[model samples]
Target: MPERPEDDDQQLGSLRPTRYATLAAWAAVGLVGGWFLHPVSELVNATAPVVSWAQPLALFLVAAILGVTAHATWRSVHVRRERLEPHRAVNRLVLARACALAGALVGAGYLGYALSWLGSRSELADERVVRSAVAALGGLATVVTALLLERACRVRNGPDQA
Candidate 1:
């Protein structure tokens, strides 16, 4: 084997790329917990708080931020026109991964919450279902954007670029 340079890059820990199965597992956990949330609340005569537009709005905002960052990363890394600092790139990659897992869990939770509201007699059920579904959609977007950002953060050179 050829001798390698002694640099910090050689010492930095490498993390495996995020996988669909891992995300699915986290979502499943969130779904089960969220599915039970309503029944548990009802069992204790607790009031289910009404969901509003803000929940989905906030989730969408997070997705938008990730999307924007992904775009910038793609332009900088893929185009070969600019270079990102090593630390900044690493930080962004970490952020993307963390957000991807969070998005899956959050999206699934909201989806399960929406499912739980189906066939319910509560006056707010309709609103809850609608808002929760929209929130779930936002969570999906966050996951997609975060994954894109993670891919964009990869530093490739020469024939292995793919």
Candidate 2:
């Protein structure tokens, strides 16, 4: 007569991998954001150059930390040396997915902004291009780290893997 909670849980158990279409959608949003922010970025850079350098460094550091953590978690699980708490693992997986999406958006936006600066002869344009490139690299690192983290969360053929 009534649906059981277990039935809901069963439906949710069929976990699927992240889709490329989702990533592409996020990237599209980022492209729009970058296009819209280009003028503002130019204005900000004219006043202060710190953000252009700092943002990329921050993103890169985040990526590195996530990557290391993912590696450790994967190794521990693969060897059966440690057990990951269910809640913690779930949280990490969610974080990884969010980062992956965000990274794609940020990377696309930076690239778009950089492209907008191409063909400009001003000294500021040169600086913007370099900074944008660095930021884009940081974004790429974030995406890679997130993807690795997601992969690490997958269970192999074991009963407790999920």
Candidate 3:
């Protein structure tokens, strides 16, 4: 069963934190969907799109940006270096939650795609698997950074709270 948030969370207008189970569910969906892509394309005689280094690099860049955001948020809110606006914090929190879920799906999807290429005779199989695996790792990093951002948004007990 999903956890029920305490009354105080609602009273403070805070959203319930994103759950790992939900991410897992999305990843499962992506995995199954990705596994079918190759076979379906083959049946239709369509070629698979090339997986490139640029894809993984972009994901890694996003992860880096999120990590910086998380660190900034942690300093502003948790460390009390500066006061953060309520709306901005909420926005960041929502972005973090959404990205975390998205990252999980993308990661699993790439992993499934890579697995499908294993033992295949095509010369492209090795390239696809290697590139897809790197992309999957980038996606995992995105998820980790996003989760860190979410955790950074938490408001610790301070002099104002009861």
Candidate 4:
């Protein structure tokens, strides 16, 4: 027998748990990728002194963003085809937003440190501490932003939390 619309809606809600599972899996993959990217990027930085400019690094970051966007787009399409609202995939969106914010903070922090290192006359300990504090603040901001986004999405898509 063909499924009823309510049955479909039930199935659609089921997608939420599946989406959460996918988000968890993707988070694991991202963690592995982070490890891999670190050594690879460090090696590139250490060995390829010729191309360590803003342009190449910026392009690299752009490419990484594009790749992530593509992955998200594909997953969103899949969810839509299953009759689910993409925004209801809260877990995935939250995870992606958190990761994106974290990455942005780390990249900006490293850039700040590099600029300070290049401009400073001495490698002062206090300066290092200040730079680290700045990076910590960036991480805190990212966490706050992720929490806000998640809350917003939840309020828009679901009933109010008690």
- Clash pairs (backbone) in predicted model 1: none
**TM-score on alpha carbons, each prediction:** 0.87, 0.82, 0.88, 0.34
Candidate 1 regions with alpha-carbon error over 4 angstroms = 1-13, 157-162
Q: Give the TM-score ranking, best first.
A: 3, 1, 2, 4
Per-candidate Cα lDDT values, in order, are 0.87, 0.80, 0.86, 0.43
Candidate 4 lDDT over 38-102, as tens digits, reads 33654688421111244334534544554555454444444333332555455546564655455
In the range 95-127, model 1's lDDT, one tens digit per residue, is 999999999998899998999999998999999
Query: Cα lDDT for residue 155, model 3?
Result: 76
- Greater-TM-score candidate between 2 and 3: 3
> Could you give me the TM-score of model 1 versus the true structure?
0.87
lDDT of 2 by residue, 84-158 (tens): 788878888998999999999998888777776779776687888788878888888999899898888877544
Q: In candidate 4, how many Å is residue 24 off?
A: 12
Once superposed on the true structure, which residue ranges of model 4 sit more than 4 Å away at CA? 1-122, 156-162
Top-TM-score candidate index: 3
Per-residue lDDT tens digits for candidate 3, residues 63-139, read 99999999988987767656678789889998899889989898888888898899999979999999999998988
Regions more than 4 Å wrong, model 3: 1-12, 157-162
* Between candidates 1 and 3, the lDDT winner: 1
> Positional deviation of 15 in candidate 2, in angstroms?
2.8
Reference-based lDDT, residue 162, model 2? 32
What TM-score does candidate 4 reach? 0.34
